[model samples]
Target: MAIKEGLRPGGRSARVQESIHSAVRELLETHQRSTLTVPQIAARAGVTPSTIYRRWGDLSVLLADVALARMQPDGEPANTGSLRGDVRAWAEQYLDEMSSEPGRNMLRDVQCSQTPGYCVAIIGAQLQAILERYPDQPGPSVDRLINLLAAPTVFRILFSAAALEVEELHRLVDIALGQ
Candidate 1:
């Protein structure tokens, strides 16, 4: 029994870590970043502040990990033969993913003061990946169109509860393509 117990990886510590992370994520999704605190998270996780500090070092690091986990890299966009189709499809995917609870919480973390630099870097990488996904001659035009369409959706995601509907997407496409 002792050997079996010893052989069990992570034992209680791993469960504690996962519980803390899940609690943090839940708190972040429902509450503003400013409201998130070590004690609150620890209480929700049923652990002590010292346990969190010992494992993650600090609140910022712990929050960053939570945000990163929530923003797990989505698969790259697919090529649909035409830039317009590709851009629209990409926009759809981006909106769908970013509308999730974790995604919204990730945005909150980025906009909050805890890790502005890290957030900028992450957003930049996402933008660059978006640009790279559609590299064709009218590339600049397509990129700009994508930006114009995405900006408002991003605004809504960050600032309001407005859902991006298919009609809005179609309208944006028309405006972007001058149709």
Candidate 2:
């Protein structure tokens, strides 16, 4: 079955993906990621190692897939009553989350994936939701915000010794907003 399930409920591929993803999540709760291997994951997932390789390419890719899935927005952005406020709040939140240990690991997993665009689209959709909230006002495009806001934040978190300060995040918001 294809790793990328159609998400059709109860389908064979969907069930397989679900079990595999669940198995990975379960194992991570008990074991260090460095200790995991294709064989172990396959055994826990009740699928063959060949199945995992054929679908996801490698364990890193599979972990990346799981990370991307987890990164999808749970709900709409916070409503702060103004585009600036909402955008700023979102940026601050983004910086906070992405700079953390787990978030950093997830970002690393995503970088190892072949489909980085999917992760970008996920973040873009999140920003789009914030943009949609204030339709009456002009705001930066999601692409622009990603370039100015998210990109820098991710860069600092991934490359720099420290994540952006809240002050820096605020400045990024100002720039992204063209303020």
Scored by lDDT, the top model is 2
TM-score, every prediction: 0.57, 0.91
Tens digits of per-residue lDDT, candidate 2, 43-162, equal: 999999998898888999899888777787778888989999988888888888888887898898888766648877888888899899888989999999999989999999999999
After superposing candidate 2, which stretches have Cα over 4 Å from the reference? 1-10
Candidate 1 at residue 163, lDDT? 64
Q: Write the per-residue lDDT of candidate 1 for residues 79-144, one digit (tens) a residue.
A: 676666766776787688777765676666545334345544544455456456656634445345
In terms of TM-score, the best-performing candidate is 2
Clash pairs for candidate 2: none
Worst ten in a row by lDDT for model 2: 1-10
The CA lDDT of each predicted structure is 0.66, 0.85
lDDT of 2 at 24: 87
